[model samples]
Target: MTTPGEGWKTPELRAAEAQVDARFKQAQDLANRLRDTPLPPVPPVDFAAIARQVERAAQERDAPEQLKALKRKVDAGEFTWEDVVSGKAAQDPDVQAMQQENVNKMKQAFQMLREGMAADEIMAAQDPRRHRDDGDENPPDVFTEDKW
Candidate 1:
């Protein structure tokens, strides 16, 4: 009733082959699903915006170093909530100095803009993480892009 190699397979051998076929079919189905799956899109980075945010945070953290008089007064608790609430705190010499620094920085920025440079260009100039071209060789802004 059997033909060639089919006559040599015992019932146990036939059962094993059936199990192998079932597993192979399952594996193929899984591989097909994986091949058809779509990957998520990658988000683009705004390095200039990130640089601006970090610079702002650094300015706040550097207050103690920039405003020595302000730090001393703040540590001594000389100014009360009432002084701040009544707007007297704005008249402080240290606060005025800080305002002047901000004004000077803004002036320099405006001058750069008047020279036809973009805001992002100014930010990039100030960003230490940026790499520059030496006029002879072209380079990527971010050093991590060397592989490109």
Candidate 2:
């Protein structure tokens, strides 16, 4: 090993430095060649035309599949054109039942509100924690003044 203050002029170091200098010269020559070469001009793109072509191709590919699905639904008696036009095709029986249940619950809630029941009373009545068995004749009064 060389001393800290010694110049780095050992034979091995000189050989390494020469190799690096040769590599640098080669890289510079490549850069010069690249700079001297002429590049081809880029043509302008028509994005709208490309988008239209893609949309047309997609429509062509998807049309038969969509028609087949519609035909299957019609054959199964699951849909009609009148249902589609009336926006009722989306509402199946399960969806209708759920909507009706919700409406009934809302009506009951409104009736309770009109009868001067507090919101907390309504919520407490609906709370799972307060659930009782059908055999229990009298459910506990959630609105009792002493409970609070």
Candidate 3:
């Protein structure tokens, strides 16, 4: 009956194994020493306070440029409460331009809808192959064909 260590009986191999064991023991001892060492105390964190500050900063950072400009104008007292209430503040060139753009987009969408309905009607009337029953035809069998 042969043993597992029978092939490792050589003196050179034994010496190599001893060296590896010694290095492993040294590494374990170092790890144990590090585990016993004292660490610096960590300051207590206020997570809720940090989260609130982060949210406020993000809201400020993510505000739109136009909104920021409006805020600046309001803060500078360029317009009175009556101007805002009476819709005079909305008469700013930028606001007017944006409203005009929205109106133009709505007009274009109505035009597209009208043109699309006309096109669909024309296609349905003219095209004979619009909705044919494809399942009526038999599919070609590759096994029966000799062209391959």
Candidate 4:
């Protein structure tokens, strides 16, 4: 290799320098485009509040009396967690009401779904509106009155 001072000013060095200059220009152009482009606004979220709520829920579940009481209630009755929360055992009326509301909502949804399905089946069978006429397709020979 040529000495450092002499090599720095040579045509090869100038070419290498030019290449570096071009790369720098390209990088600057990319940076400029990135700067000009608009980005979506960050979501407004309370991470601290979410963390505190999670911690509180964990503490409530881990509390000695609460866990013991919950277990005692479970042992005393044939009840799931939902029943414990909603069935006359919940100390807090608000929690009881919320759980009962949830149970009622689920029951209502299930009943509505059953009714809807029944109505759909009934409509499909009785109503001529949505019924389609069969083209030339016929039953297989196995379904016909034939010797087994």
Candidate 5:
């Protein structure tokens, strides 16, 4: 719509101006398309996963032989955490002796209990001298001369 001069233009000039205007409009359309179109999305980054990968790579680099040996054993089914076993545990003689003593005491107690049940007496009539049925409350202590 804007002209450079006030004078009337010839046919070729007008045609040339129209061609230039069309090309300018085409260029503007291309510019608009480029501005309006969306760009491709960028993928999300996983820093933690990257860090773990780096750590594993470093460990493998540092101990390649050990890792390979372990892998070989695993692949051949020669080793397993469940299959690992402990040797016979060492027993202390003192502890074994104590256990035997306790076992003997328990056996004696059970025998005494069985005898009491057969005789209808819960106790073996608790040694007569150890517990007296006398009505005396206080008994005199006969101390030695040194204790006195």
Candidate 6:
């Protein structure tokens, strides 16, 4: 049987292998240091200060031109009672209750819309071509069949 080449046991090859092992050990030590090191605490966000800044900005802003552009629409009766009622201008208790009610209605509408879209995707997945079965029966109707 022929012996393996002498280069396999050469000084350079052995040095390269030792260098790789040393680099791996260094990487492990770095990882351990990072894992043990405590991260700096995050500073708290000042929402009240941000709100004051926003209020100040809005008060100082030159919005007359923007308001002037909308003045025509306001004068032309394009702005309806419902439009203003949905905004912050209507801040009474009754208006707040109405806003909450409208928000609930919108949430329900969006949830139904999402469920309908999901149902369509599920119905498409149930198509026979999507997966092959060993002559098994169709899957149960989730809507029609109730566990209760």
Per-prediction TM-score to the true structure, in the order listed: 0.37, 0.31, 0.31, 0.31, 0.25, 0.27
> Which sections of candidate 6 miss by over 4 Å?
1-9, 45-148
**Pairs of colliding residues, candidate 6:** none
Cα lDDT tens digits for candidate 5, 43-134: 97655565455335335533334344433443466643122211111143322443465467567667878766533242333322324445
Q: What alpha-carbon RMSD in Å does predicted model 1 have with respect to the real structure?
A: 22.5
Residue-level lDDT of model 4, residues 1-148, one tens digit each, is: 3455674487877788789999999999999999999999998765556545533543553333444444455555644344443344466444355456657756765676677756555555543333545431232332434433
Model 4, residue 17: what's the lDDT? 78
lDDT of 6 by residue, 1-148 (tens): 1246755576777778788999999999999999999999999765556545533433433423333333334446665333433353354443355457657756765676677756444444544433545333434332333433
Best by lDDT: 1
Q: Considering lDDT, which of the candidate structures 1 and 4 is the better prediction for this target?
A: 1
- Top TM-score model: 1
Model 4 regions more than 4 Å off = 1-8, 53-148
Tens-place lDDT digits, model 2, residues 70-116 = 44564577865344334465466533443465577678778889999
- lDDT values for all models: 0.63, 0.58, 0.56, 0.55, 0.50, 0.52
**Residue 15's C-alpha lDDT in candidate 6?**
77
User: Can you give the lDDT of residue 128 in candidate 5?
Assistant: 29
- Which of the predicted structures, 2 or 6, would earn the higher TM-score when compared with the native? 2
**Model 1 steric clash total:** 0
Question: How many residue pairs clash in each candidate at the backbone level?
Answer: 0, 0, 0, 0, 0, 0
Give candidate 2's error at residue 15 in angstroms.
1.8
Per residue, candidate 1 scores C-alpha lDDT tens digits across 1-148 of 2467688799888888889999999999999999999988988765556545533543553333435555566557876333432446778876677557767778888899999999888766655334355432334443444455
Better of 2 and 4 by TM-score: 2
> Lowest-scoring 10 consecutive residues by lDDT in candidate 4?
135-144
